[model samples]
Target: MQQPQDQTTTLQKTFRIILGVFMIAAAVGHLSFQRSEFQAQVPNWSPLSKDLTVILSGIVEAALGLGMVFWKKQRIKVGIALAIFYVLIFPGNIAQYLNHTNAFGLDTDAKRLARLFFQPVLILWAIWSTGALSHLTKKFKG
Candidate 1:
């Protein structure tokens, strides 16, 4: 018979897996729909070529999102990767919000503004699933 705590752990893991897959699908769809828009949004002075940057960002996001399903032992690493990805894309989100730019038919300032708030939730969700609780426990262990 399974203990209550064990059941909870299983549920958490299942939720994480589902969430990870959803994230990967969203990123893939974004790449398909807005690759060119993302490339144009890249700042010219940035070190990477726009094409390379957009493609690499898509690849990294897809990999990290998928990696969450199989990289249980390295959840912390995945969390870090996801957090960094969010930070890197923050500027583009901000630009969209500021300029009210309509790319790929996302022609709404409110939606872009909402994206600024929505992305942080993903960052938090990734951290929470990956190891935020464990990290907090360690801090309080002293």
Candidate 2:
């Protein structure tokens, strides 16, 4: 019998697809109707201007989303890349909470603070859904 790669369950596949679609939708929001709201997440300390950073990141998100949806041959790498992307952008999320910039309906301090907790979940989603977490763990155990 041909051994299966990744060995991902049906649920994981579904989660991967859903996360890809979510990313694509978020890219649309970043580029189109919700630009300013996204800008609220950019840190002022960024060397790039907020709009430029937002647009560039949106372009990257679109590419990553497309990869996640179609690049079955390299799902693990894509997942790691996406998780890193989440890690890199996390500071902006923090800045949003600290700066108290209102956007994305996270208006109150409690709401903003709560939203901070979701970043790790996104990171895990990217890793777990793509099977990168298992892949990396196996490599380390070798």
Candidate 3:
């Protein structure tokens, strides 16, 4: 008989795959014609050139996206890593809102501020969709 945890894990795996595809699509936006749009999210205070930062982040996102989908044996590790990535990029989101820079249809301060609230959701999605929460819980409890 299949356990409840097994069903939950399967559901989480499916969600992880969906998140992986979303990341890959976003990475493509970062690297292609929308590159300049992505640059708007990079803080002016950043030491790196905007183009370089966008390209590097695009590459990293693509790798993480693929890893999340294909690296099942290491899914928990990938989930943790992706969560950290989301946290790291959150500053850029804040910079966009605070600096009044516009991109990806986030035209006004209200829209930008609203978007800021989604970052935590992405972080949680990464964790929950990969079963990383449960994995970490078990690791810490043992």
Candidate 4:
């Protein structure tokens, strides 16, 4: 459980920064070194070319990363956006598993299947770190 106070605790603040940095690093990978590997995760049904889809997601990741780190006033929104982003990209993860596409050291179906379970953790991390989970919970509570 996380503290639902208006201000985030030091732990949440630290984790948010860490997640931000991780996203930035992933963005770099998407744009440069891991371009081909990332293409492996792009679903075949996507309307955009794989390279273009990877590029767009890279841009989005970078923007969200920067927002998470520097946009304190808007982090709740950023966290929400990032959570949504994770949801949007989930199909790519599914495609990786279902298509038996090998990339990012997840060569086996078991590896890929395990990776799918981590997405929700990332989503929860985003929401919890930014207090969005509590905020959202409150919005729906009577």
Candidate 5:
């Protein structure tokens, strides 16, 4: 009996939950066995040590992942924050490509460059999966 829009919203929420689980898994990688691989993605010029950057970002990702899963009333806000986090970390991806650092099996120039293009997709995924894009559009149109 759900309206079309309601069905779409339900799908979006489902996608957001999946994305949340994905984020949590990735955060575990950042903090555990895959830590060194993640360190290669940290920019060489970062003021913080690579390990610290990895650890801090891992913590943030875990928090954001949890928020996406449980903060229904604030999902739009969580989505926006997750999108911003994707944006903020993009420079590290860029640096990895530019420096030719090998990590996460992105061992070739082509692979690294291709990976660079996924950052925007992650940003969009975060926003879209939580209906934040629609919510923001309506807010701005008002």
Candidate 6:
């Protein structure tokens, strides 16, 4: 019989798998039909041209999504990469929230405000699912 700790570990693993899949889908969905929309949502300070940004972001997001599926080491690398990407894109999310930039049918001001909160949650979810929190805990505990 599995111990309680072992059960928890299994639960955590399951959560991670689900979270990874969701993040991957989000990343891919951003790249799919919404590519142009994502470009328009970008803040002015971003480096890529509108079209290039769309294409490149799509590529990166898709790759990051796929990274969650590889071997353990690769998953860790991908998680770190994705965390960086999440940080980088934060401004764009803010721009959308502040400027009321409409895309992907998020027209309501309330919806935009809600989205401001939601993106960060997704980032946190990704971080937790990637086992980064555990690593941090271990580092701090030791």
Each candidate's lDDT (Cα)? 0.70, 0.90, 0.88, 0.93, 0.88, 0.67
50 Cα displacement, candidate 5 (Å): 0.3
Candidate 4 residues 11-80, lDDT tens each?
A: 9999999999999999999999999999999999999999999999999999999988998888888999
lDDT: which candidate is best? 4
lDDT per residue for candidate 1 within 1-142, as digits (tens), equals 2211221266567766876797687568557876788775566566888778777787877888787787776666676677777888888778777777776565788777877898888777776676645664665897
TM-score of 5: 0.92
TM-score of each model, paired residue for residue: 0.75, 0.95, 0.92, 0.95, 0.92, 0.78
After superposition, candidate 1 runs with Cα above 4 Å error:
1-8, 30-33
**Model 3 segments beyond 4 Å from truth?**
1-8
Higher-scoring candidate on lDDT, 1 or 5: 5
- Poorest stretch of ten by lDDT in candidate 5: 1-10
On residues 1-142, what C-alpha lDDT tens digit does candidate 5 reach at each position?
Answer: 2212422377788889998998899999999999999999999999999999999999999999998888877777788999999999999999999999999999999999999889898899899987788877786999
lDDT of 6 by residue, 1-142 (tens): 2111221255555665776676567667666776778876788777777667767777777677666655345444555577778888888878887778888787878887787777677666565666665655665999
The list of candidate 2 runs beyond 4 A from truth reads 1-4
Q: Going through the candidates in order, what is the number of backbone clashes in each?
A: 0, 0, 0, 0, 0, 0
Model 1 CA lDDT for position 136? 45
- Name the best candidate (by TM-score): 2
What are the candidates' C-alpha RMSDs? 4.9, 2.7, 3.8, 3.3, 4.0, 5.0
**Candidate 1: residue pairs that collide:** none
**In candidate 4, how many Å is residue 41 off?**
0.1
Ranking according to TM-score, highest score first: 2, 4, 5, 3, 6, 1
In candidate 6, position 124 carries an lDDT of: 64
